[model samples]
Target: MLLRRRRFPILQHLGVFSNPRSFLLHPLHSPQYSSSKRNREQLLNSMRDLKTVDAALDFFNKMVAMNPFPSVKDFNCLCSIVVKMKHYTTAISLIKRMHSLGVKIDSWTLNIVVNCLCRLKRTVFGLSILGLMFKIGLEPTVVTINTIVNGLCVEGNVEQALGLAERIENMGYESDSYTHGAIINGLCKVGDTSVAIGYLRKVEKRGCKLNVVAYSAIMDGLCKDGLVPEALGLWSEMTGKGIQPTLVTYNCLIKGLCDFGRWQDAAILLGMMMKKGIMPDVQTFSAIVDNFCKEGMITRAESVIGFMVRMGVEPNDFTYNAMINAHCLQNQMKEAMDVLDMMVRKGCLPCTVTYTSLIHGWCKIKNMNKAMSLLCEMINKGLSPNICTWNALIGGLCKVWKPLAAKELIFTMQKHGQLPNLRTYAIILDGLFKCNFYSEAISLFRALEQMNLDRHILIYSIVLDGMCSFGKLNDARELFSCLPAKGLKINVYTYTIMIKGLCKEGLLDDAEDLLMNMEENGCPPNACTYNVLVQGLLRIYDILRSAKYLQLMKGKGFSADATTTELLISSFSGIKGENAFQEFLQKLVGV
Candidate 1:
């Protein structure tokens, strides 16, 4: 029904298509135009042959000036072409012109208007158009409901979309696959993967054979939720139902496995995909390489890159960034720079992430000059230094015992339009703390409180640990007490830091009290907490209490860490109670 006519011999007979543009610009002035059926048919055919917006507009303008208006289908066809050209606003305006011309509007015409409104994120206007369709005695179709549901999903109103779908079902309208897919995708977007799976199962039970798109949405949600095993279950179910897994499905599962560090399983999945004739894409290779880089398997990551090249999938920025970051993690600055040079030689322009990784690497080795050089190079290349780049520089300067210089870099970053983010603040505060600039750290921390950022538990823990290190027990305690009032939950790290501080000051009783009541306050101690407590008790020569904590630590499946073991062995060796300590050591070491 949409313009399939190829022959234009009739156009020559009508003298239209030869100079179609001129014919469109000038209207036919025949007095008998309203009665000429053949003339109207020729005009409609010519409008369909129009390939450009300019010519289409001319045709439309000339048609509007005619004594008898063009047929609605002819107008609809022109509007459809405009919408396809992505001039959705123009299509809506043309619809208004049709109404002004007293052309009877149909459901198809209104559907186009609803679709455009939805695309523009004006779902409320789309609903009004749906209402107009109903007022004109037109029942909404599946396509109409699907468009509205998708619009609601895009606007993050999944709950309302679900209610709409339910209402449509109650009105005896069977929801189609697209409608269900939209709802499932919305649930996934809102992190309600469990609810999404429920909807999926309900659809399956109702004999609605869902496709790979529906399964893929739920699997992606499950993967993101870190429920990879459950995602695998869905994959198995999909295959059992004769719904073959798509590339997206396999990628989701592979990424989920890689995230969990199940490298063997990921490799097996890759092989399975290849065996099934699903060619590995650039994203597939990037995910593999990135995960291997994270696990410090640099050789394997490089091999994946080589294989990607052989397979005709060119390595991208993500591929090189992963490879560069792997080298940087070990402070192998030369190797990282070589990767950067290789990337440049291959015509792949290095991005912020590429330079940031090298900057972080140089910073790890306390080489601020190299880091600053890369920063300048990136800027010279028209790339702005992101917050990570600044954080790496500041943290690196601090690590090399230049906290004051690191502090200055923070101000410089602000001057360059890079606001100090939460990590930036943490890096600077940590540097100040480690360099024994306690007062400066405290001052900056108080300044952080006035800012609009959420003072996360890690931020609180960092300052608390700093105060504890400087023997400011009272200051640490005051900060600790204010956590609940600030709507911050005290985590295990916070509890452990406070406990260590109390023990360091020889306040063993207070430390023990805090340790015992940690779970009551919803901050249960971890293995690190118990190890610190054991070391603390031993420092005070409380042999009996130290042995008790050691036994408790063992019962919790936590071995005394090397530091604790060495502390006990060195402090008690050749001492008066050496035999009793030796007996405790036997229990700890299973000797």
Candidate 2:
């Protein structure tokens, strides 16, 4: 049998008895050069040229059935092509098939497997494949190391990734720009830009020229951490070193500028980017539009949308949401709804943010009917209301004097797997207090207290104000006194509320003492506090004390409120002509 195999090579046994030169030169000439090898080559070429997943799969199935299987290189090539088509799971299966066919998996093949696993977010499995490479004695190249680091970073194991990068470099594997880039990127993602910049300098010291991706990573981290000036300085430094900023660099800077309300600088940067032939993407436009919306610059936001469309960049859901939110901020619900309609007509579905902004707008105007209608529409569309959406709806109901309905909605939300957060509770308590449902608010507060939910200063203030509103001055005083012991710093609002409550009870001395104490504690009262006090004094007809507060308010640049102004006018109008009241009016005018 051995002598026969030597006499006729393996190809001849497979009925490929053709001249080798004819097979190599005119491989498709069937009468002269048809062979299994040519058939496999044609199949490999077909696999490479495949544009769709189904075609790649069909060719892959055919390639696996050959008697003398294809070379490992050919198999790896097919697997790579499949992976590039984003058929990652299929690529993994193909790798397994190669292993099953007793085809050896070299480092390159295993690297492809690692990449596919990482793409699937199975970085742990990718690590196992790296271990397999070690077990098979296949030396890992820089690509393998970088792939592992990237996988670790994607899985948010930045610390482990850094350690691996260090180990590989210490093992004399000579970390490349890609390896250090992965580590730097991981550091930046975890908000360790300070350390990431250190590593960046280390990479430069390693004799590897840092690339745009590495620089962009650090800039992005700095920007996200609200260090826009530092990020911009770094940009200047990068450009000074002849490193031209890419689209990513410009986008990061633009976002950073917008975050800090540096709109003028952002526009300048946008102009510079366009001048450099780098087009702004949806993210860039979205950031600008969102910032404008937040600033209540709806017209400017619309102009940006027009510019985006003119630039051939179609607005996405986020773009529409920004516009919707802008109109909502200005209480322009009709225009907001019109934008929503336009977005839907363009096949862009309104997301949670879109609905939330609209609901909040209607709630702002106490239009619970419209809010509820929109809420129902959202649910009918199978979009579940999130905590923010619930908060807006509940707050709206409360604003419309429907605390009972708002409470019911809260329970309904919990039943539907949306837990009420502290903000939700705060909204409900304020609503109940304002609507005179004190008993219900107290019950809810006790329930939350029993559950050990954190009571922030705002919640405490709300409860205190509620007690004072209902003539429970003792309870309000008790809570107010316990604020410091509860580890809550008495903010200006808190002090102001306590002062207002005391004044309401006609405890002017106590109110005056608290005001003095707040000033002593450096929690100086604001204009609202002074206004409240001035109004309170005027209500009691303490003209001299009221004038003292009014003068103080004026000295501090606060105008007397409408009620105070009306009372002053009435009090002066009733006085005899050219009397003491006329002199007081002249004094007040000079003030």
lDDT (C-alpha, whole model) for all candidates: 0.83, 0.81
Weakest 10 consecutive residues of candidate 1 by summed lDDT: 1-10
Provide backbone clash counts, one per model: 0, 0
How well does candidate 2 match the true structure in TM-score terms?
0.88
Task: After the best TM-score superposition of candidate 1, give how far the Cα of residue 155 lies from its true spot, in angstroms.
Answer: 2.6
Candidate with maximal lDDT: 1
Provide the lowest-lDDT 10-residue window in model 2.
10-19
* Shift in Å, residue 481, candidate 2: 1.4
For residues 468-523, write the lDDT of model 1, one tens digit per residue: 99888998999899989988888888899999999999999999999998978877
TM-scores, each model vs. reference: 0.79, 0.88
Q: Report the error of model 1 at residue 13, Å.
A: 41
- Collision pairs in model 2: none
Kindly provide the TM-score of model 1 when superposed on the true structure, using C-alpha atoms: 0.79
